[model samples]
Target: MNHIPSLNDIKEVHERIKPFIHHTPVLSSASINELAGCEIYFKCENFQKIGAFKARGGMNAVLSLSKEEQEKGITTHSSGNHAQAIALAAKTVGTKAYIVMPSNAPIIKKNGVKALNGEIIECEPTLEARESTVQQVIDRTGATFIHPFNNYDVIAGQATATLELIEEVPNLQVVMAPVGGGGLLSGTALATHYLLPEAEIISGEPEGAADAILSFKSGKIEKAPYIKTIADGLMTNLGDKTLEIIRMYVKDIILVSDEEIIAAMRLIWERLKIVIEPSCAVPFAALLKQKERFAGKKVGIILTGGNVDLGKLPF
Candidate 1:
């Protein structure tokens, strides 16, 4: 099992990555407020560099390496955003990056990796295959492997977004984020529990990739035999460290269906004039689908990323 990042670790990550990351703006909507009966604040991480919040963690992990380790380069397996984040971060730090991605990864993400001058290794869409391919690249190039959401440094880095959000919206009563490998949720839980102890830290999971939901309910880790969702970003299973943090600090994990995700995506696009991927829309889907439960509260939802293939818009 991997080491879990604590609040102090997150604070260090924030300090290290602060100069490299954007404290993305938070947007509010009276329209959404009326619907959910809550004052809704959306942290627009979609506006972040690399079109996602992954850049913070990517930069932190890459920059933290020793000069010799950095000279060997960095490697990771990602569907899209994380690959681009690592690629761009490596470029910023004067190093190289090798990304392992599934053959079925979105073209926008694949191209983004290439655009950043990162080498790409295409593999089958299974977890085992992704890991094996990443290891092969690491062994061949001697590149440092940066696990997408499992590493303590990576999770701590991802938590910085929540830290900024809470600081900006001090009155927030509840916070929600999309969960996949649970890195962001774990980091967010740690930060929110420390800063806003009264805040309810909730996780939004795609019904297609609701392993976290099942894990929370079963009081143990669980896996979906196969991921089936348009929300490609949320298809990953929870990591051991992430599950431990979620069990300790997360208030609940809510599941949203593909249809609900689509509806929320469309709604955000039409109303907020913001483009969010299916994974980023899951939290909104939960707010809309579970209105009775989330109503009459001050909710902060992290809009995790916006790297969508415009040509593949399901709407």
Candidate 2:
């Protein structure tokens, strides 16, 4: 697997997706700064197209394809954001998208996919079931697979967010993002290491889905037996390439509980006026829960996505 993505690769992706995607703003709060005791600069990826950072990777992957490949279309399995990103990107490129999603996926995300005119294949929630269903779709349609997190182009595209973040805030001392399959974390680590060499790259994971944390500690890829948390987007085993990047650049992994995540969500909603999902709240939760470690430091946090269903607020 290709684990390394050079600065040039990230630079190319920055150019490819710039016209289509927003350079989502970075936000800060003196109030939240008072609570967390750190100078936090939040990269508002939650405000991005498709309401997630996945748009960068998805758009880059779709746009990189040749005209012939576009004619054949694309396929992938995702819980939400990736599906919407690919669906929207394919539509922009005048191509078709076949997305396999778990039956349990949020209704808002499924609707977002349909809104982009992407065909949906509903399957059971297990990884095996999702992969099997996607395989059948691929075998029948011959659409190129756009992996959610594991592909080289996908990782490179995701890295562009950190590229912009670091460029905008060059003095950042520490950078952090929530890790699921490690796509965002991998890309962030690669870009930060290359662009801001002295910055510490960290990842926040839900206590229920802390595979990346365990993997970092044990020096091996790990997976939780079952994930039980409101942060649906952060529930997955770390991919092989992602693990390699984590080993190379990520300084540490921190765990946040569901309660802490809810508190963080409320803090963002009340203070930042951002409607981020539980997955996006993990990093803030880590900072709030572990205040001593980050006190007075210049911290960068990726508010990864804001695709939560308004009606389903767990408050």
Candidate 3:
């Protein structure tokens, strides 16, 4: 598959994932906008199937696989959302999924994976450990590996959400998403480039997991330190493919503190009356961090997920 997705490829991805994923709403709040001093449109992927946008890429990767490969099964590693994405996608495609999750991953996410019949392999909460465990599973089961955010097909699948957002609300000056692995942001950049070329693609990242910001500036891949943040889903570092795409397409990446993330998340829940995970609030935190830059601008924010364990509410 081409690393670069054409407009047609993005359209096809929408069609492919349409039956399996929800075209989540583009929401806005007068109160939140008044507070942030910007016209912010939220692409609520919190409402997506599996309660996250990863369902698009994960399902697309599964559907893009050959029948022979699908028969063998699908495998991936995720701290939370993508594990459930692959599991749900595999179930939809009539294939088995093997997920390597961090031993410390949220029990809600673990239960989500198991409920979809995905076989879970718990590994230490580190990219190195997850990669090693995934390799072991691949070797044992001869399964096709569907990387959560690195593969071309997966990125293409991720693009559809942005595509739908642009269609719903065109003339957006900037589109932003919480960047973890770059799959969703990369896809978003492509969609904005083709559908709304005037739009700028911005990425929001946790300061604790600011590898993407470092990599974008340094022109190389960088790993995040082992700092614990509420945004568990964004803890993993970026991949080579994702890094390259972000370097080319993304205009800027802003980092926010964990405290800001929690506050932004609380604001969203209170104002929007929706459940958004901490990872999802990073973009709004970015906007708040730099309110002058986005003042009076029509900004689109992708709420990345809603799968928070109620037992562990940060607020």
On lDDT, the candidate that comes out on top is: 2
As a TM-score, model 3 comes out at 0.95
Q: Give the winner by lDDT: 1 or 3.
A: 3
* C-alpha local distance difference test of each model: 0.86, 0.90, 0.89
Q: Candidate 3 on 113-170: residue-level lDDT in tens?
A: 9999999999998879999999999999999888778889999998999888989997
Candidate 1 lDDT tens digits, 42-108: 9999999998989988888898899999999999998768899899889988889999999998777
Off by over 4 Å in 2: 1-3
TM-scores, one per candidate = 0.94, 0.96, 0.95
Model 2 pairs in collision? none
Task: Indicate whether candidate 1 or candidate 2 has the larger lDDT.
Answer: 2
> How many collisions per candidate?
0, 0, 0
Position 160, candidate 1: lDDT:
91
lDDT of 1: 0.86
**On a 0 to 1 TM-score scale, where does candidate 1 land against the true structure?**
0.94
Worst 10 residues of 3 by lDDT: 220-229
